[model samples]
Target: MSSRAPWIVFGSALAGYLAVGITLSLRFGFILGDALSRTAAAQAVLLSRDPHVSAIGFIFTPLTGLAQLPMVAFASWWPAITRWNISGITVSAAFMAGAVVMVHGICRDRGLPGRYRILITVVFAINPMIVFYGANGMSEAGFLFLLCWAVRRLIRWVGTDDVHDLLLAGIALGLAFLARYEGVVPIALAAVLVAVVTACRRGREHWKDMRRRAVLDAVLISGPGTAMFLVWITTSWLITGEALAQLSSSYGNTAILTQSGGASGDLVQTTAFSLGAFIALGPTLLVTFPLAVVLATRRRDLEFVVAPLLFGGVLAFQAGSYITGSTFGFLRFFICAIPLAAVVVVQLFPAAGDLPTRRAGAYRRHRPSCPPMRTAAAVAAAVLCVSALPVTAWAMLQPSLSSQQYALGYLLAGDPSAADSEATTARRVIDSFATERELAAYLDGQALPDGSILVDSVYGFAVLAASEYPRRFVIPSDLDFTQILNDPAAAGVRYLLTVPNEGRGVSDAINRRYPTIYDNGAQLYPLELEVPNTGADQPDWRLYRVPS
Candidate 1:
């Protein structure tokens, strides 16, 4: 393999990602709600006086926002960068490029030929879900990058038994945890695998020495990540005054899981839904995954099998989340498994002829006959390759079938007027936000007294996007809206912008507590004064003046 091959692959993938990021930003304008929220949080971190209070809590981890601070600060100085959220999108794309590079490195480390390495990198870079998220302001890309690096480091550690490698792996996993909560699974899995593998190798030659090393490896792999998780939880508690603020809140995943339906039927339905979504996103994985497992087993290659184990672990975690109803149905959740799947596929065919025959005494004693196993493995690989070829070709042809497309289709499915084209859906999304943009413009024009406006969660992004003084508006999404309304003066709320679609409980309570001063399908009730609407969308926004 040429020394420049990985860099060539990385540079090409980065260029492609940047182009896609720019195009998607211009066309869709950051369509995902989560992306918008993360953008808003990044802005809060950089621009707000009180970031801990102003930024949305629990649902978001802070690393992505913190990472965006430099770009957000730059954008503040140069407003043109804010046009397409170039800063955020660029950061995501860069991380995605890093992920592709990591994939190439992992393949190379596993002794895959340069051609196969390039093929895996190309396949991963062009994956629709990966491309879509890579072009947006989301954490998935960043998390995947960290995850790939961590896995690579662990693989290196296992092969070389270098404590430094294990420590680096732990640090990467810790950072990954900060990027996304699901990172804990990798940390835990790595720790257990290290302990198990080390213990299995123990013998009289160095019994105590091997046991000590095994214990050290386990601790090194898990310690930093676990400590990071606890620190984040502690910080959340101190800031929000809830020890488990990230988990206990009504908006948190734990609450969602608790409220979700419980039954064996729900489990089965969710599992099927998750698998179906995975297939839709990456159909080639279905063949590649099992084929890799068969090949690895035939060769008795412990390191090769780790790829499948890691991929399976991620899938199982997602399946468990779905069954428990802790997560919403989304294709992005399955993304972590994509690179591993690519590794599996690329190695499956090439490794067949490179099978290692050496085995331990225990394994040699119980090993199955070689000829039949080899023949079956060969046949399976052939079948998988043939089946996967058409699917892979189809995937390459339809590189634009992304999670955003699926989400937009689902949203528009109920609207009889929505056209089937991507342009139409993108336009509809922009049009839907027209009210928000207008409301934001109106609020900016008002130049209302500081700490005067209180906003519901639904309009948080709109307010942030459109307002000059976004931090001035109080968001009651994580708090009790009724309490804020009981003494509006005490809370320094002079006006309220109510969007009935969000937080029905809060909307209902506010409507009951105060008389309606403005009702346009979405009602705006005044606690003290009657403030008339000033040319905003009637059905989408209602503005009311609160009596001091």
Candidate 2:
């Protein structure tokens, strides 16, 4: 086992993936502090029975947070791994590590060169999408690992025409499908390619061979695959009386749209911008995909690598439906596939014809010689690594810098007597607690007994802040704050909070909607006076009395 020689490939992959994973996580992981999206995902889970959300009911709802129960369980029991940002960050990294080992083993079995295997593994490790998404709680990282493993297995089977490999490939694809619905596109593409190759080889004679082998592979893989999917479906059905209804509801919800024409335009803009962003990430990928097309024509060398690229493309296409302007997130969706494309590009460089060559399977084989510039290779690696520095640094710093700039804007425009007594209230608001403490403390001082408080934040805060008063602070399903202001029931709100920096237009609108009752200037607002309800620039809230 030690002499099998793929461990070097595994080690190199682990080291590179870990380095990129840690670097990205050091910044992206902690920015929200304890402000996890628990409400989004958890609410989906809780309301799994709601018809609108039922389409997604079978699957663990991501609207709450990134990690699934299985993922959380694994992280919790794993020694030296805490179930927080850093630990959760390792989930995708660990999956990539396993994928690298699997791919290395498969390549070694195919008698690919050790050096080549190491090189491709490194390429996979540094793949931008892989590094970015794998460290995130998002499902894309796990899906990529499963999809890549399946593709490698499928290709290995096609190259060798081994039933064991074929069956394993099916199982891997099946698992990939369970991980992400988009995985089916890649699996179908792979199956079609394999079937076509088998048919052309011996005509009718090959037909039977292909059918029998494919059937056996499908049966073997489908056993576990079907079971995994059924579990989610059955649970969703039991909970919501329909399989995937939560997902369907979540997918179909478009109530946020202000106008149909505007929404349609937004969708078009999203698709165009997403495509532009993907192209910008690497114009080389558009070129590289054609190489995949050319390579796919080689029946014996049929790498299922194209499957993932196709699947990613399919997912990218779906980004058009996202009305919330989340198209930028699609870049991370295609990140892992970029490195694979780079590796295939590297493989296309023809081996020097006149160089010293060792016949395949020679023990301690002669290194394929003739490239005299070892320094050039080292320089190339250094250049690629350093080239990413500017981007990595920019991505890490942009959020923090933008937040600081935003705080400054608020500070300058904010009124001292209305918001807070001090002029520096804006900075204090920015520097204050990263958790629910600030909002909770402000509510506690109001002494209003058991009624909803409206705030523009994710629902998790609403739940946590109101834990002492169950169902007191419900997230208004109808987000018409204008209507809430006029309604007598809402006019008596005990505590009104605004995350002026985080919400869309709520920051500017808040100041415009309410008169300043009392302001310390920056944050401490105590309502001691009333003024006309004219929509002019004012403090965040103007409390109107409810006549008894």
Candidate 3:
């Protein structure tokens, strides 16, 4: 195979998806909130009144925002980048396309035929959920990329016992930890697999030797990720005085999940919801996963052990998190399962030509005496993968199944009626946050002084990022935020943006300081305007003119 084949696949995939991302932004106003919020944080590193590195954030892993920093820093020159969140879209599309390259590389390392590699990549790429995350500027795309990269290297290390491959895999996961906290599950699992595999292969009689080498290899594989996690928490603690702030902070994942009522469903129902999500995106996982384990057990083909388990472990961890009230019931959490299926499919089928030399416990090209049955099996696997697309598309359109996916689904559905609804709250419900943009524009027109507006970033990140004059507002990241929140009028604060004190809005600083601020300005300020919450997904915002 040409070394350039992966680059060609990457460039072609990137170009196509980057176009999809741009069109999604321009036509339907489709963008993910987490992406927007992360991009806002990235832009605030320089664009905010505080303009410090700590402005990036304290809780959620920072890689997604750090990846956007370069493009976000340029947002001043290209206003559309931050406003439309093209910076995030570009990062996601490029990372997703790189994931396509890793898919090809994984298949190739197992010596699969070119045609099979291309087939698996296409089937993986065409899944609507996959493409949506790739083009919509979410962390899932980057997480998928790093997950595949780690799995690919670990597969090689398990096959060849190359220390270099193991080290690179650890670094990929270390970076993945920065991408999403879910990376911890796979990193920990990978370390266990390394230790167990080493013990079994390296020591037949010398138990002590086996234990020592296994422990060492496990440390080599696990060290980087563990260190990264510790450093991240330490940094959060140093900055915010709260370690694991993502769980304890008012703006953290648990807070958001509790606030949204997402954790209120019964465990059995949520488990059922999880299985349905997996089936839609990775139906092949049902068949190929078992096949990988069977093949690994029978032929000592350890490549299958590392790849499937790394991806599968993450999926299990996410499903468990949702069931236990630790996270939201989002279909996107299962995206890793799609690539897991792709890796398994490529291994299940025989290549067009056998390898010149085979490594023991590596991939064994399955050779069935009945050639026709082999072809039939491969065809059936491919069919199972392709069939998932329509099921995934159907699932995305169902609000009960995927409220996060509805706007893109409506646009992709291509119904003229659905497109028309873009203006009627269908698109703006979550993605557009169109009212926030209108508020930003309205506020920009006023002669508001610097530090005149007081709003909590938890709810006001979008409006602040969208504003042409961002520094006019005094946000939580500002140094004097605590002092000013106590008595805004005396601190030169003029306007206050207050959301209804419900759900996630309960933590808003303004609401906390004066519980009746939104309803009656707590007898200290006057209501200037009320922006009705667009889709009932967010709170109705009340703008107050503080008596400064």
Candidate 4:
């Protein structure tokens, strides 16, 4: 295949992804799921009195929102851009497109045949999770792109022993850390691997020199990335008046773990479950991934081992999150490994007969042509790639459902609407509450004096997006629904909007704590306020007057 062929393929795939993303944004008015919160966060940052002290601090990382700032600013200047989620979707789609290109580059670096590289790149580019997240306004696509680029650079450094490559890898990893907190896993792993390799070289005559170099390498690789994280944390502290404010907040990972009662069992089980979830994302991977690993080990292939090790590091992070009960079941967390695993599976196969031959001794050694094992590997990989198609199609069609649903929804039914009816029902409730214009007008009309509203993070986004006075609202991360209700006036809250059908435990708690406020089941009546019932399956947004 020609050198230009992969670029052409990448371009085509990227165009396709962009088209899908644009279409979804046009149809839905926003990218679904967390994209809503992310968009709102970006808007909040742009509109906040002090961007540092805004609700953006309550979220995971500010990089995604900050990244959207330019586009958000552009949208403010150009009304046409606001019709769809052009900024967020474009950013995400661009990252995903870059990832596809990186996959091709990784394949090319590994000396895989052009056909195999193209095939692997296409498969990864169109994988359900990749397609869905790529087009949405989320951080996963950007994080995945940086991760693939960093891993590729790291592998190149390992092969060529070039310090420049190592530095580049560190830089990429550092940028990735800024993209998402999970990016630290690779940085930590790379540092530890450098130290381990240096220690294992102790028998050499230049052992002391190697040790010194290794220490420097480890520091160089981890230092910048660590610094980026520290700067963010320190800035957050200065802004929020709490060190580690991101993690200590109610929405923080540590708080979530504590709320979940911590990990229930051994770390091994958590790891296994996490790995299982990753495999379940691409079911055929269950067969092909292990076979590829075994074959790669038998062949003593560094590329294969390194790829899986990097992917394993990512899974280990997820497993840690699971074990600590910081997060339970979000498969997009594992999507970064999918492309890497696909590359490994494709590389496991023997190159096609037409491929150009490299110099005999230059690590392009061919196997002894074992038909049985080769055929088995090829068949397993084919099965895995083919198996992903159904889910990929479903996800492309229904990008609104969560990644877990994408992985398992098909088993419930073939038709997406039937398979994920629960999501549809929930969405109906959400749409009813998405009464941005109506709610904003009503709140403005009320003209309550010295009044502010308190809402959960989810509804906080809704309120912020719908209101002109977003700064007046408080989304207290430290308080629960009951706590907030106990002294709403003290918290400067004059009204509370509750969506009972959403099934948030806090919503249920609020209902139980103040049954009189919710006498009409899903409706609340206080200060003679009545929540309009939009329709059946719609969330009953019960607005209540907070007691002074």
Candidate 5:
């Protein structure tokens, strides 16, 4: 493998994705609320009055926030980075660039020609799901980076019996959990695969000895991920008082999903819901998927099994989750299938120089029927990979398929009528960002002492991040947040920034504490301002004064 190939892929991808991200964010004012929330959480670590690592919040996995720290640190002076969520874009772009490099590595490892490697990598890089998530600063890009890294390492370990490869794969899967909660699916599947492969490798060994070897090898491959999983829960329990706050907290996933009225269908409906997303973004899965599964069974090859189980397992888990009403049917949710399919392409039709398989195949008698048949499949895979781009671009404009940014597609196509009221309003959505600035400006002018303005980072993260004086606000990340929230007036908190008690807003800390506070200040506090939500994807904010 040429060492320079990865750098070329990474550098080009980084530059191209950064350009798209920055243009969409700065030039067109397109940004994502989830991405902004991550940036806000990262800022809590360095800019909050408490200024502790734990300030990064516990609801979401920590690595994405932790990953933003380096860029988030600059937000103090480079306000635009946080204001426009540019720092998040930078992080996502970098991770996605790295993900593309992993896809390139798989192509090389499978002995694909240089041109085919370039084609596979390019197809993955230019996919709409990849480009959008890579620029949007969500955890998907980083999660994909870790997932792809782990997949390549797993394939290498399966072929070479390299402990180092196994360990590296395990470590990546471990960190992948910190990137996205769904990572647990891969970690579990990888362990099972490792055990199966290890046991099957024993030919003349004792049954007990083979069993022992299989168990140890499985543990070795999965130990890091298991440990990391424990560490994450322990950390969250310590700070948030709930081990799975990301799921159970009032401001957590279940609360938000319920509030948004998500998971609107039965099992079959949800399955179709998920499949539509997968088909739109990962059309290449159509061919590679069957080929991957059939080849592993036909050849009984452990190496070929890596693609279907390691990567395809995650895809299946997402589909299952949707079918079970565990996750929303988002286009980006099935993005890993893109790389899974690309890797399967290489596995299905590796060229003669595929070193790993060549060495392992010493015991095998199976071969392709003829070179022409293999060539035909390889060409078809490449064609599908290229075709996925336009197919995805078309899918991105359909709101039912591309829930997150389908409006952007319509807006770009100059068909504003095709988009909904929210989309029409979102094209000029910077008003909400400015509204946060205005609110922060008002709070900063009051010269509130530290912990004077009580707000939950769940929804108020935008205002907290926009403020020049973040210390003036007492967020959940604060060491004394619970104390201040209990009796704001007694705790010297002068103001409460709250959202109306409706939908997800009711889960906001303030609304829960004073259920009727948003309506009439609960007769205990005076309403100071009613800031109407001026942008899409945001709730109207209510500022109330706590009598001291």
Candidate 6:
């Protein structure tokens, strides 16, 4: 248990986690999900108006909008996932740095040997989801860091029965929840454990004293967390018109949740995959399960204290989710429990006593030497770290890695090569419509400048057109919607932008009534001709010029 061993293990673990993060980011970089998330962040940045302002208006902006401020500031900074992806990296790194400190704090407090401490650090660094999800720009990494830090604080508080400690725990949990909704699980669990511990004190005087302190701790901890929560809700309402709009508009929508009706399968598969990752990581459930088994017979009291916290966190997370795919792909959601599992594994093996100390205390204070086990464990840990390389490499080549296969693999992987490939393919596919660009150029060159132009393409057409002529263009948010029927553009638009992505319903509604003013693979039609009314699918697109 050399003192320097922890540092060695820390460096090795960090290197491995970063290797996986970089690989996934480059591979999945071009995915639409990454792009959309980047766009959302970019839009947030654009809306910031002033990055240095720090006004309530800055805070009032939606999170998505604020995340994009960096992107909006520098157009050349365009990356598929927004320039703020760097912020995501910062957030993840902050949490991880905190965890490393927390691990050292816990090891010192417990007076564990260097080998045991190194093993615990190894457990944390190699946790699979931690490596994969923490590397992305999402809140999962920060949230996990807070959750782990809070648990460490809770452990210390329990030992000292300190109100300040409890308050710190509360603040961490509150901030974790602010980062992501799923953070409430660990927060609630910690509160419950504190309450139970207070209630279990033996003497009447001790019980009363502990109870009073417990209540005070609860108040101090819960107060700031509650206030922050309310602030989050208020901020959401100011931006989106509702307090829970982000969750309600997307995750809670039943249409998306039960898209195929057999959502049970999705849930089952996700649960299985999550469980599998936990085992594969070798530091989490793999360590905890063995600890639980060994402790049940050898140290039942410690098992009672640890098992419930471990199991409860997992159960609470599972119970809270409403949708199937919500937990399916991203392992980051499960990283919250990794620290607990690592603690359990560390606690499972009794430390080997110093030879002189053992001789001094003899039977009165003897502990097993853990140094021998450290060498074997280090070897095993090295093998596990090496095993991840092939899995990561294989992940890079899969179609899911190259595409936004959110249903199957890590969401934050952000494969840059894959993203670049997709971007190229999207451009090529869009370029096939030579006429769309021609009409767009012609429209840009036109005299009319104050009205909207209708269009049907999803990404390239709408993005390019809108980017080129912001005021005169209007795009459908719905990817599958047909043309503007009653001609909303008729009232104001001087011209139309059409693309092949539009199906029959659009052409049937407007093509017969509008004469072809310009025809190409991308067609431009004048609203001067007459046509019948029928709700049917039609050809790609024809731009029409409405007479003023």
Best-fitting candidate, scored by lDDT: 3
lDDT of 4 by residue, 1-548 (tens): 46786567667767877887886556533335456567667665665322433545544676676777787655445523322456678778778888888887776666554555666777888787787778876888888888888877766655555666667778888888878887888889888775655544444676676787779878877787888888887877876666665467645556555544655566776676666556555555666677777876776554455556666788777767777766765657777557766766766674322223222212233433222335455555656676776754554234342433332333223324746765554444334334543665577577654336655544445455555554555454332334655667676678876555233323333444555454553243364355665422334466777656
Error of 6 at 227 (Å): 2.4
- lDDT (CA) per prediction: 0.62, 0.43, 0.80, 0.61, 0.79, 0.46
RMSD of each: 6.8, 10.6, 3.6, 6.9, 3.3, 10.0
TM-score: model 6 vs. ground truth: 0.60
Q: Model 6 over residues 332-438: C-alpha lDDT tens digits?
A: 43444455555555554443443221122111223344433455654554354445444433443344322222222333333336557544443332223233334
TM-score of each: 0.78, 0.57, 0.92, 0.74, 0.91, 0.60
- Which segments of model 6 are wrong by more than 4 Å? 1-39, 46-87, 202-209, 238-241, 250-255, 258-262, 265-287, 290-315, 319-332, 350-548
Ranked by lDDT, the better of candidates 1 and 3 is 3
Sorting all predicted structures by lDDT, with the top scorer first, yields 3, 5, 1, 4, 6, 2
lDDT of 2 by residue, 1-548 (tens): 53655566555655665565555334222212222233223332232212133322333333223343334323323411221234445555566666666555544443444565555555555544455454443555566667667656554554455556556766776677665655555565556555555554455665765676545444554455566566666766676566764344232123113212224446655666456544534444555556545644552234434444444555554454443542223344444444454434443332222212222211111223342335454344434433543443343223222222123234234444554533344444433322343344444456665444544322223223223332233233223445654442544544454432222222233333443412321243444323321111112333323332
Error of 2 at 166 (Å): 2.4
Candidate 5: tens digits of C-alpha lDDT, residues 231-326: 888988986789998889887888788888877768777878788877777787786777777866766656777766766777888888778776
In angstroms, the error of model 6 at 261 is 5.8
User: Which runs in model 2 stand beyond 4 Å of their true positions?
Assistant: 1-84, 102-112, 198-201, 204-227, 250-271, 291-300, 304-329, 339-343, 346-458, 461-548
**Clashing residue pairs in candidate 5 (N, C-alpha, C atoms within 3 angstroms):** none
lDDT agreement of model 6 with the native: 0.46
Lowest lDDT block of 10, candidate 6: 529-538
Q: Which ten residues in a row have the lowest lDDT in candidate 4?
A: 354-363
